[model samples]
Target: MPDLAISATGLTKTFGGVPAVRGIDLAVPAGSIYGILGPNGAGKTTTLRMLLGIIDPDGGERRILGSADPLAVAPLVGYLPEERGLYPGMTGREAIAFMGALRGLSLAEGRRRAVALLADHGLPADRPIRTLSKGMAQLVQLLGTMVHEPRLIVLDEPFSGLDAINQQRLEGLIRAQAAGGATILFSTHVIAHAERLCERIAIIAGGEVRFEGEIATARARLPSRVRLSTKVADGAWHAALPADAVLRDGVWQFQLPQGGIEPLLAALIDAKAGIETLAIEPPSLHEAFVAIVGAEPDPVAEALS
Candidate 1:
């Protein structure tokens, strides 16, 4: 069995009599990339805050890094908040070193690490935060968060402002971190990032978790897809196709029924249908997410742009 980096039971929070998070349980395994997925106003940030001990939970309990008190294990955790906060006058290196100091590093060691980290990412250590572009500053802040080399990294909406190029870089960084044995927990409404990066995921909607487990399990909630294009315009095999199948551009596309595609193929072969092409595609994470959480605005597309 794998160790849990974060464990929460019936965690709940409220503000002004309106529930922000309601009885959400999370178990993030050690040394894996985990994602909390939800749309805007889905209590993602609130839950993170509670787990980090930045805010008190109205009910339930949480244990982070095996400690009931998150503050006690603060040095083992690195956090990049949804809201960007960096001193305008501080140089990139200075900002990073300062964060490291807060995480228990000596000032001199922090500065040394900051210089190395900034240079590694192609940023000038001496450059002031205000002088850097928004994207550059974001990267600098991220480097600051990791300067102390915490065992677990938690990022809330880290992809919010990044363009495609930077997003890819961040993904690579995340993989690199996990490869180095750090557990990563991030919250995002952008489905594509979670699909690509997370091994385990929790889907939150309207302040509640609709599903939680392996990404493959979430995807398995939906059926596979089949696309068939035939030479024959009409045949008995048509009866074997799903009733919901749609024909578009001379191709028939539909969800495959459970059990297997063998039954469909056998039927087509028996009917003597002239088969031009047949394809079977696995269900996508987005499709499964939709199946679990219902239709949501195209936030992934919106986030990419």
Candidate 2:
């Protein structure tokens, strides 16, 4: 096992006596990328905020970088909240320096680092943040988050307003940071962004952690999808498909049938129709997300049936 970067046990919170986050437990290893995924109002942001010490957890304890008391370890961490805030009156350089200073750096050192950050992140140095595009503004914030050279960085919705090109750039930067030994914790509704970067993730819903584990482990829990294509159409062959098979564009796609693939493969071969191609689409992060969150329906109406 890798060195632990963050650990929280029985972390709970509430708003107006209503439970906002249940007894959630999470662990992130050093030098790895971790993602928190959930729908809107699922308390992901709230959990991250509490972890960053911007807000206190109503119950339980959170340890950062091995220190169970996070407040004493603030200098080793960097955080970017979901709500982006910058001094509109200040130029990009000054705004970034201000953020760096808040994280414990001299004004001169902060300004110098800010200038270098512009070069590193490919941002215009002299432009005021208010005059920049949202994508540009997001880049500036990302730079600010890393300006102080912290070993642990947390970002909330880092790709909210980025274009395709910018998103790719940010993704590359994240990979580079982890390779250099920084533990990254970020939250996003966009699952594809974490496809190649995240090693582990926590899926949250209704203020509770529904899932927490490595990306591969989460995927293993969901069966692989089977897709088939045939060179010849045979109505009788269609009848041989599993009852739950989904017919799409003359192709049959289905979850791993209850009997598994061997029986299905044998039946297809016995059908006597020429086979063109057979493919198994791996379960994507997006599909897993939908399966977990979308499973909760209105039971009041569903039970009436």
Candidate 3:
């Protein structure tokens, strides 16, 4: 098996006598981008806190960077929590440098790195964080998270408040970090972000992990959809179509056959059916998530209640 930056088995947590996370398992491969995908209040934050040692799991075990105690490897991990904050009076550079100092980086080196990071991202480093826009402030904090050049990066709802442009920029930054040999794990409710970035993902609902594995694996749980248009539909080829095939808006829509499309293609050709168009679409991540989790109550809210 490949090296793992983070691993957990049967992790569980409770808040106020109510279950918040229930028997979660995860294996985050080194240098890979993984995602925890779920709706709001799905216990994502609780699970992450447990893995990072900020909160203890009620049951199960976790290892970070080959160490059983996550705190022992603190300097190697960078984290941006869902709740964002920075000293309002501190300049962007100072804020970043302070965060780096907490992680054992020298203030001078941190400031230097902060300058370069801000310049590269077209953000102002000398201005007080309170004077910056919300997106800018968030980006500064994210830069702080990376100032020490951590081996693993964790982001909680990282894209929650950004506009489309900033969100795209953040996505690019995530890709660049992963390219630089950092293991990145982020939690987000937006399916599009996870679909675009994650090599593997865990889908959570009702405080439980409903699915986990490669994105393609999740998508493959559902059959590919086939849309075919033919001039001669009333023929032997009709027998090749699926039993539930529906003809609507000049197209025959059905699930791809288990035997594959080759047999159907042969039947269509043998019957001289004039195939106008044929398209096969695999299930999207959104569709897979819905199929796995259905509609569940917000676990965090339930816990609070």
Instruction: Point out the higher-scoring one by lDDT: 1 or 3.
Output: 3
Q: Local error of candidate 3 at 43, Å?
A: 1.3
lDDT (0 to 1) per candidate: 0.91, 0.81, 0.92
Name the runs in model 1 displaced over 4 angstroms.
297-305
Candidate 1 residue-wise lDDT, 1-305, digit = tens: 49999999999998999999999999999999999998788899999999999999999999999999999999999999999999999999899999999999998999999999888888989978999988889999999999999999999999888888888888988999999999999999888899999989999998899999999999888888899987787888778887879999999999887767787789888888778999989888887888898977366565583
Instruction: Give the per-residue lDDT of model 2 (tens digit) for 227-256.
Output: 888877764567667787887998888887
Error of 1 at 305 (Å): 7.4
Instruction: Give residue 183's lDDT in candidate 1 (0 to 100).
Output: 94
Candidate 1 C-alpha error for residue 22, in Å: 0.8
Over 4 Å off in model 3, which ranges? 232-236, 296-305
Of models 1 and 3, which has the larger TM-score?
1
Give the number of the best model, judged by lDDT: 3
Q: What TM value does model 3 have?
A: 0.92
Ten-residue segment with the worst summed lDDT in candidate 2?
Answer: 296-305
Question: For residues 37-70, what per-residue lDDT tens digits would candidate 3 score against the true structure?
Answer: 9888899999999999999999999999999999
Which 10-residue window of candidate 3 scores lowest in summed lDDT? 296-305
Model 1 worst lDDT window (10 residues): 296-305
